[model samples]
Target: MVSTVFYVFIFLLALLSYIFIKRNNREPHKRLKLPPGSMGWPYIGETLKLYSQDPNSFFAAKQKRYGEIFKTHILGCKCIMLASPEAAKFVLVTQAHLFKPTYPKSKERLIGPSALFFHQGDYHIRLRKLVQGSLSLVAIRNLVSDIQAIAVSASDSWVSGQIISTFHEMKRYSFEVGILAIFGHLEERYREELKKNYSIVDRGYNSFPTNIPGTPYKKALLARKRLSKILSEIISERKEKRLLEKDLLGCLLNSKDEKGQVLTDEQLADNIIGVLFAAQDTTASVMTWIVKYLHDHPKLLEAVKAEQKEIGKFNDLNNLPLSWTQTRKMPVSYKVVLESLRMASIISFTFREAVDDVEYKGYLIPKGWKVMPLFRNIHHNPEFFTDPQKFDPSRFEVPPKPNTFMPFGSGVHACPGNELAKLEILTMVHHLVTKFRWEVVGSESGIQYGPFPVPQEGLPARFWRESSS
Candidate 1:
């Protein structure tokens, strides 16, 4: 027994030595002279610090301690955090070819490779063109009535004085709009399934990688399977019908590349799911923030109401013919939407991997190292926006220097749905302001950030008919 115990201790020591040697041998960035940051310890690196309760604060602190560019390790990989507009433009716009979207192994497992968000080079360009053209001004203008009608219907369900979660409501609203815009008057049951599939995909993002029973990843996989099944059925149905509706799905179905080849059913389904996932979360979060901001600042609400009143009655929304010229004329409403997005940036950090060795500001960026463009830092920079913490939309009236404000990101991979997102936000805000007057319920109400930051406590607001009624 003594000999066995001694041998066990020896084995333990040997393992520790091996691990120490391996860690010591890990490539060092001595040649790069990159900016300073806390690397923490092995495996976890700065992940714990980087993902602390207040990631924004943590990032800000790091920037304060170590200028604009900083280096850190996360999940055992080297990463560089770019905060300043100069670095942002250099990395995102000027040197875009060297940087590629980077996702964790777990995320890839959930979202799949066929999704447009993950595609690169020519494929991504083609997919983006097809999707963007389908959601063009003409296409979205046609769906405006549908969107307005849905908004009215959704508002009808809200009860005065009853506590309701605006975040969830916005999710449902965006989901419905996306469905109508993408699928166009599909069966009610089919639409419900689309909502379910999105929820599954979202939940999957928060799950651990384990695919065992009861795991979130496992459930997400099941959800993906269900979503794929429905998509397959829809594709098969479309094929059989051969009637083109000219909606997004229809466009994809009818579109062919230069080689006369069309996107396969699976490819189409993945793209659809990708768009839904992207559109739903960001839009819902933005809407929720808009509501929260309006509730928090009653003066802003009044301004919005005045703008709506200038346009006419709430009921006239569907009937009132609106053109791109008219839409851009709502400057206050536009600024409010822009400010909300800037304040409650739904996506804080966009990750990219170095596709090849590159140099920026005399620092070596080795191939495969992860790069993070910390937009939150840029947005809140005092140098760019005076009193950045204050919720003021007017600041945007005189736009900040380019690349300083990228709520939807910058460069080629910038969100294609930016225009549609803006239109939807303005429409929703216009309707809400004209329809009802709401005030924040309690002092406890506040915004929260995580994956997609929104109202911490749902921004429960007590609603009453406006005095103008």
Candidate 2:
């Protein structure tokens, strides 16, 4: 009886302390005219709960309970979640000047002080101009022979009836494309070395910023130094030799701003690595899903194959690569890609912090609050997309409602390499489906969706080479 009384007394004291702390924190922010939403616990916030749930369901539940626009504390910041395309445009496109890109403290620290994705204002515009032009449709056409060679070689490696992971193969293929297009052709041994270190740096994006021994973050920083050293040596060699090849890296090296200021070696390396990092996994994820989607829907698979065959008839099918004009001929392929992008929702949202006190539909979004425009919500909304959950590429026969399809994001902060990503996916998918007929070799429930969609089993499948048949 005495021990039970002691436990009750302890519980009473804890409950009183929680009430007092809650009341204290609430008193100060009363004058801020904040949006109608909970701020959650101080400092720790709602990160624990948010991280534990599937991202799609978490956002859906919140939107259902709190309405289209609501506020919550997540990732240690007080954030406003905008769930409509109109709101997305207002925040991201219309009144974009009122906000700036804001990421978590851990993410910022991992990306470092010089990561180009964090750039804002006039500097972003100028730096973007330097890199964006080369990834355009016109520029991409110039490098088709190289991209085609790599794609064909990579696709040819899967022997008939062998159980292989399409997801794994695509990851390696995307990395190879990045290496050949960005750095020119390197020896297979050197390319493997760069790939090994890059995988290390990639882990840091989702890791804590802690620098203790044995931490992923620490290993990533060390790997970054090695990668930078490799890039710097290549730059030095090109400078000494006066090399000018028709490649992205070559274009970057020769580029200068209007002021005639060239990028420092570090800036060049950061951006080159940035492009590689950006292009690889996201495109690979899309490619993996396309394979899964096509296999699951046989009619769509045959349609894509038929489209490629029709285009192939006009070209030197054996030696000639698909030109920009032939690529444009695949309208069915374009629809399929858009559907995959929407269904997969590769990037979930774009987060920007309010620089000043901002108002949206009379709701006060105070200074320093994170403004998140949710791409997934808009893309999956039934109103904008009928039967949003269904995988039907025919919907793309008509364009999506404006601001609704943001697979690569939109506006000033849009991904400059989006055109390149689309071109790569189209090229890779075109080659794979035309050359092979495949079937799933494992359970389809293996898709792990969160942070990004990944096939847990690497999407194992059996390959049947069309030529062999």
Q: Local distance difference test, per candidate? A: 0.80, 0.81
- Count clashes in each candidate, considering only residues at least 3 apart in sequence or on different chains: 0, 0
Q: In model 1, how large is the Cα lDDT of residue 199?
A: 89
User: Per-residue lDDT of 1-469 in model 2, one digit per residue for the tens?
Assistant: 9999999999999999999889778654443565566667888777777767777788888888888898998877789999999999998889989989876656644445455677788777866776687677777776666777788888777875578888778888888888876877876766877889888888777777888988998898888888888878888988898988666778878988779988788888877887787788888889989988998999998999889876665565565668876766689898999999999887888789999878787688888989998898888899999999899999999998799899998888888878778878888777877777888886986557525776667789888777723
TM-score of candidate 1 to 2 decimals: 0.89
- Local error of candidate 1 at 3, Å? 62
Clashes by residue pair, model 1: none
TM-score for each predicted model, relative to the true structure: 0.89, 0.88
Model 2 clash pairs are none
Residue-wise C-alpha lDDT for candidate 1, range 42-79, written one tens digit per residue: 88898887666577888888899998888889766899
Best by TM-score: 1
RMSD of every prediction: 8.9, 9.7
